[model samples]
Target: MKKRLVAVAFAASVASSFACAQTPVMFSSINLNAPHDNVVHGVRLAVLHGKVSEVKGVDFSLIGMSESDRTTGANFSIAFGANKINKEMTGVSLGWFNWNTGKATGANLGLANITHDVNGLNWSAVNYSTGTTVADVGLVSLSNKSTVQVGIFNKTKHIDAVQVGLVNCADNGFFKCFPIVNFPK
Candidate 1:
C-alpha cells in the first residue's frame, strides 16, 4: 500500500521532531552561569547567577541569584539579589530575597519573603509562610494559616483574618497572645 503509506509518514515526522526538541522556546536569555534552557518564552537576563527550568516572561537578576522551576511572569532581583521559585509562582517577586518552594500566586516584594503556599501579597522585612497565607506585611510575620497579618511581630497556627501587631500570636486565636490587635472572636 505504497510502502505502508511511506512508513506512516516517516513515523509522523520523527514524532513531531522529537516533540519539538524537548521544550525549546527562547525569545531572550542572557545568563552568565548555570545551564539555561529548560523553557523560557521571553526575556531572562541574569548577570551573576541564573538557573532555569521554566519562565514565561521577564526575569531579571543583577547582582546575583535567580533560580526557577516554574514562574509565569515577573521576577526582578537587583543588588544583593535573590529570587527562587522552585515549582510555582504565578507572578511578581521583586527581591533582596524571595523564595518559594511551591505555590505562590502573586506579589512578594522582599527584604526576605519565603513561601510554601501563599495566594497573594507578602511585603517583607521577613515574612514566612509554610502553607496558606493570603496577606502578610511584615517586620516578622509567620504563618500556617493567616489570612491577614500586618506585623511588628505576628505568628499563627490559625487565624482566619486579621492581626495587626506589636505582638500577636494565634495558636487558634481568641487570645493565645495579643497586644495590639488580633481577631477571630
Candidate 2:
C-alpha cells in the first residue's frame, strides 16, 4: 500500500511539472486580476500584395500600403489618437479616412475629415520630398508615398498598389491633398 501511494504521488508530480514546462501560466490572461486594466492596447495589420475591402474601426491610427504586390479599398477610422497612414501603390487603388472623437479637447493633431488619393502619388515623402501638409487635414496623393499625420479618416472604396501613400488617384480629377482643418492661432 505504501509503495503504491509513493508511485502515484511521483507520477502526479511529474505530470504537473511536464504541464508547467509545456505552458507558461503568466502568458495567459487568467493570471491578470483585471484583464482590461492590465493589457497592451493597439491595432495593427500588414499585407503584401493583398486585397483589402471595407475596414472600419477606432484606433490610435492606421497605415496601409502596397508592398511589392497590390492592395485595394481599405477604409478605417482613428478614434481618438495620432494617425499616420502611408501606402505604396503600383496596380491597385486605395481609399480611407480618419476621425478624432475624444471629449477632452486641446490636442488637435487628429482627424476632422477629408479624402485621400484623389490622384496617384505626386512625390516620395519617406525618402525625397520636402512637402508638408496639414496634420489634421485630409490628403490624397499618388506620390511615391504619403506620411499623413492624423487620428482618423474614413474611406469610400478599396484600392490596390505597390508602395502607395494615400490613394492612387492618377485618374481621379479633383480628389487631391485637401486640408481638413486649419492650424492653431
Candidate 3:
C-alpha cells in the first residue's frame, strides 16, 4: 500500500510539473488583424497585423505590421509593411521599415533599418544603429561604432575599420570629415 502511494505521488508531481510549464508551442498560427499566442514554434501568418511575444520560426505579415518581443527565425513584412522586433532578433528581418530595439544578429534589409546593436549586416536606404554595427551598407548609415560603412553618407562616433562613402565623418578617425574614405588613426 505504501509503494502504491509513493508511485501515485511521483506521477502526480511529474504531471504537475508539465502543467505548470508556461511556454506554449503552436505549429501554426493565423492572425487576421489581431494578436496571436505568446510563443509560436512554427509559422505565424498575419493578414493585416500581428503582435506576439516570441516566435521561433517564420513570422510573415502581408500588407501590414508585424511586432514581436523576440524572434529566432525569419521575420518578414511584405508589400511595404513594417517589422518591429522589440527585444532581440537572431535571424533575418525584411520589410519596409525594420526596427529592432535590443539587438539584431543577422541581416536587416529594408528601406529603413534601425537597431540598437547589429552583428551582421544592415542593408537599407537608411541604416541607423545606436550601439554598434559590424557592417552598414545604405545610402545613409549612422552608428556609434561601425566596422565597415559603405554608403553615400556615413557618420559614426568611432570606427575601427573603414568608411567608404561620398561623405564620411568619424569623430575618432584620422580625419574628422573626409570626402571618400575615412579610417581610424
Give model 2's TM-score versus the native structure.
Answer: 0.18
Model 1 stretches astray by more than 4 angstroms: 1-45, 48-51, 54-61, 70-78, 88-95, 101-110, 117-124, 130-138, 146-151, 157-166, 174-177, 180-185
lDDT of 2 by residue, 88-174 (tens): 222211223221111111112212222133232221112112232212223422222233332222122211221122332311212
Q: What would the per-residue lDDT of candidate 3 be over residues 13-123, giving only the tens digit for each residue?
A: 978875675433332223532223477666776555677888888888777777889999998787767888998999999888999999889999999998999989999
Model 3 alpha-carbon miss at residue 164, Å: 0.3
For model 3, name the residue pairs that clash: none
TM-score comparison, 1 vs 3, better candidate: 3
Where model 2 places Cα greater than 4 Å from the true spot, the runs are 1-70, 81-185
Measured on C-alpha atoms, candidate 1 has an lDDT of 0.82
Could you tell me every candidate's TM-score relative to the true structure?
0.39, 0.18, 0.80
Q: How many residue pairs clash in each candidate?
A: 0, 46, 0
- Cα lDDT, model 2, residue 108: 20
Identify the runs in model 3 with alpha carbons over 4 angstroms from their true place. 1-36
lDDT of 3 at 150: 97
